[model samples]
Target: MKLATQAIRHVDLFAGIGGLRRAFDAVGSHCTFSSEWDGFSQQTYEANFRDNRKVDGRDLRDVQAGEIDDHDILLAGFPCQPFSIAGVSKKNSLGRDHGFADLTQGTLFFDVVRILKRWRPAGFLLENVKNLKSHDGGRTFEVIRRTLEEDLGYELHYRVINALHYLPQNRERIVIVGFKEPTSFSWDRLVLPPIGQTKMSSILHPEDGSEDPEGEYTLGPRAEVNSKYTLSDKLWNYLQGYAEKHRAAGNGFGYGLVGPDDTCRTLSARYYKDGSEILVKQDGRRNPRRLTPRECARLMGYDDTFRIPVSDTQAYKQFGNSVAVPVFEEVARIMLPEIERIKKSKPQTLQAVA
Candidate 1:
């Protein structure tokens, strides 16, 4: 969608493997700056986007807002594990702090606030887990809303969008869109494809001579998936036993197995452990398998052209932590017109003091 006549410059924060960068880039925006802390994710981000300037690898808490470059839009899929449901549950079970109480990741959002207050970009897009809205009995979301709307005075709009509308994964994330000045911006402008239209088959390795084999993810002349992806008998038996135990207690804990035509559960950073959440069903007596890193990429709505320059373990975590590309592509598409309007209405000049 051609929404802008001139290129919009955006900064990517907490940029995990450049998923949000890919979305903004796809819509003709330029990424002037990016910051991601993890070295592995930084490696993958660098490998994928040759045009991106050096990604700041430093902790954002140590970086001042004045050091960042001016940009028209700010994009951040800031660390969400601190506010996610699974993360909260795990932290509670461990008697650890979560949400705003978690000192490390929970405070990163304030850094985002620091930049927003300094740059006052025409628009900004923030993404996080859907559970963020309900965290701390809505008090967490209240603080965020007040910070962005009442304190900063940005026109804010947010919605919890399911990636199933654009991909085969049942991932849901809350996207927050804001503009510096009031303009016509509505969620109705988003063009979402029908849910369940895309299936696992669309992203799965066909293993029918349709594609060439990659280094180790697929093998042989037929380009079948390598046997390494299949779960071992020991692990499979253990997962089954674990699920049965949970079931006996009427707990909801279990593995999710799905075939080609079905939509799968959310892929999580912990998938590297056992791939229990979303297992690929196998034929005959073979055990189910985890999705290859390439499939995980496609499952998150990334095209085959995207590079995976890290180990499979890192790849799983990166993709799991990434935003669904198509969802944000549509978001970017709808936000561009308003961003351009606001840019034209109020030209940005560097503040005398920030």
Candidate 2:
């Protein structure tokens, strides 16, 4: 099948190992600029994208906006620690000024606005936690909308899409797309096949299956677990104790018992800290284990080709902090016609010379 030809050019910010970049790239888009803070991510981005100049080079906060030119779209999976439910809950205790005014809003969002005002790219795609809507009684989102819409003159469309639609994981995120002009883009017709019938078992390699996968999502050794590492009777009781407390307080989080026959909940970078959320069943044993980094990549719709270049820790962090590739690809398919309409309506014009 022939691919979409009216390619969209883009820049990626907070480009963790190019997850947003991969999404846009899959849709036939070209990425011209990328900014990432972590050294491992920088190395992985360069290895995958082969763009040494921007991938490992400049810091987003220090780079001058004028130098970044000729990109039609800007993509950012901006830091969520400032806006996530878990992050916002522990804000005041960090011994720092907090909230939108002191901590979250004005800092990174301002950097994006500075680029928007200076470069004025044709469109932008930004991702954040779904809780960003409710944080500070919705003021944080209001600030972002005001900055992007009224101040920058962009028509914005946003929706919370779950990764289970295209993958075996239950990851959910809010994706906001904006255009420089009053856009006629209609997302109502956008339809993506739900992978509801797909379970974690489908992604795993069968004992005799030909596919040679790196690892299975089974219980592995943990320093704390020691020789008693298996989720034995005592461990099950501990999980029950934790669950009971949260159940009493009406909390839905803390510990989750995911079944191999079903999908998993959201995977976070903290999954590495302690495999609390989506632990897998051990092979030949009954104990629950944390999904390996490779499994996390699979749930996030990344293949072995997309991995094999980053370390386990970096891979987990990048996938955990990424936009689902197929999700963005579907949006791009929906928006392609609109992009063509844009070009037909107003062809490129040469700036007036002094």
Candidate 3:
């Protein structure tokens, strides 16, 4: 069956493992360009999206802003390190500057802005941690929002959503969307599909008796068991304290020792450091281990067809660096219907399909 030509084109920035790419790919959006600085992510993106194979690990600053050609949309999951918890911790008492210009993300956004000025794509999608709204006293986020709306004259819409709404993962992110015309799209009316009911059992593959697909996640160690790792007083106390604090406020921040028949939490880049954030509980097991990078991939809604050609270390980094693909796909679906309505209302032109 032939697919309809994309009504819009997109370019991905910080295209880690092409998570943003995969989402658009699923929605019939064509990628006109892609850029990533990490070698491993570049490799994985190339293996999966052959058309984006030319993307090099070039510093975005080096790319002349006006060099990018005309495209329909731009997807930029810029570096979140500048606004993440880790970033704040690093900046705290580090005796370093972290304003919009001094931080890493500050610079990346500039590149994106430059590209926006040059390419002037009809729309743009940006992803970042929810904390961005509060980062650096909120100045960092202010600069970003202003650049796109006030400075660039875009109709901006943003939302803070959790991945659990679309997948089995408990993750939160802020997605910023901008259109050339604010009235061009109504962000508020964009409803989503049901966050289907699922269980940990579905995420977990069969025990020794079953075979996973050749390119699927390795089934060597579903989880690890160790007394020292599992029976630590520090972790237990932390979890206990977290639960108490949240309970006091009528919220929940405690550990979730889930089985395969449960939904998971947001996977972090720091997950490689320790899986303490979210550990899976197996029946009759003395210890619980953190979910593997592959599990993280599934939690992020990446299909097995999406190649993780990079090493485990690289895989974790890319996954941490990625946007939830399913989220983007849903956005595109909602936007597509509206775009088609616009197309039907007017005399059709090749540029409309371009």
Candidate 4:
């Protein structure tokens, strides 16, 4: 189906390095405003999207809804830490509150709600970790659903989508979609390529002199992966012992070692620490290496042309915190037709009787 001919304006909240922006941009949408709180993320975002005029670098809680520009749709991949499995586990071990109780990042969802209520956009798309549905034993999701559906009066639809359909990473995220008025939106409209159809080789750098070496990620005319990515013998031995211990205890906690033909585990923000989640196998007796930042970009469904103007650590976190671009691109494609329908159905603003 043909998408809306008119430009659909969208505001990006918690815009992590503009992943969602790239997705919507693919389907011919314009970003009117954006808000991202991280200083490093703001830097990377500004560097890549220098033309954006209204990118807010401040915390969303401090910014009023009236300060935002009017737009046709709201897009938020809001902070998922409070609702993530790893995040909750970490918090629990630390004896800290999680979910809505966390108060810092946990409460950020309300910011999205306020913007939607104030602007009453034709529709909105929200993304978070797949664990959100089960967080707090499903209480968290219940609150979100009630607020969006009953309180603000929007027709909400959500589903968990895995990135393995589009990229090599086995990442699953919950996508929440809501419309100001009911339309024929359905999950059946989303087209997903067969799972595991895309293998790790698709994203791994060939290193065969075919692709130019990126800065620090690869080297020489042959574009060989830099040695820095290879795990040090000390760390490798430690990880092996740790995995062995866990295995003996009948626990599934261990590093994920993968080859070109195999898909990797979810790349988390902690990847820069040890890269345990996805270690690429090496030839001979060499230790498996962490994916270079470039490979991480590809694993996250980002094209090479997308700028990575940050340190390796920051780039890892940014990519880890981002959504798979192609997954959202398909979502945007399916939503555009319905968004246009909702906009067209709005009653014409009545003129004053002269």
How would you encode candidate 3's per-residue C-alpha lDDT over 1-354 as one tens digit per residue? Answer: 112243666788888888887887677777877888878778888888877248857878877655554566788998777677766678766965554655455578888888887656667889888988888788878888888999988878888877776777777889888776534566566565556465555555444536453333443443232233343556656766877899999996666677766777667776665565677765675556555566667777886566777766677767866888778777776565544443345434424211
Among these predictions, the greatest TM-score belongs to: 1
Q: What would the TM-scores of all predictions be?
A: 0.98, 0.86, 0.81, 0.96
Residues 144-179 of candidate 1 have per-residue lDDT tens digits of: 999999999999999999999989999999999998
- Scored against the true structure, residue 185 in model 4 reaches a CA lDDT of 94
Which 10-residue window in model 1 sums to the lowest lDDT?
345-354
Return the candidate ranking by TM-score, descending. Answer: 1, 4, 2, 3
**Runs in model 2 lying further than 4 Å from the true structure:** 1-3, 52-57, 93-99, 102-106, 213-241, 244-250, 349-354
- The most accurate candidate by lDDT is 1
Each candidate: RMSD? 1.2, 4.3, 5.0, 2.7
TM-score of 3: 0.81
Cα-based RMSD of candidate 3: 5.0
Pairwise TM-score winner, candidates 2 and 3: 2
Backbone collisions counted per model: 0, 1, 8, 0
Q: What lDDT would each prediction earn against the true structure? A: 0.90, 0.71, 0.69, 0.89
Residue pairs with backbone atoms closer than 3 Å in model 3 (clashes): 170-266, 199-261, 199-262, 200-260, 200-261, 200-262, 201-260, 201-261
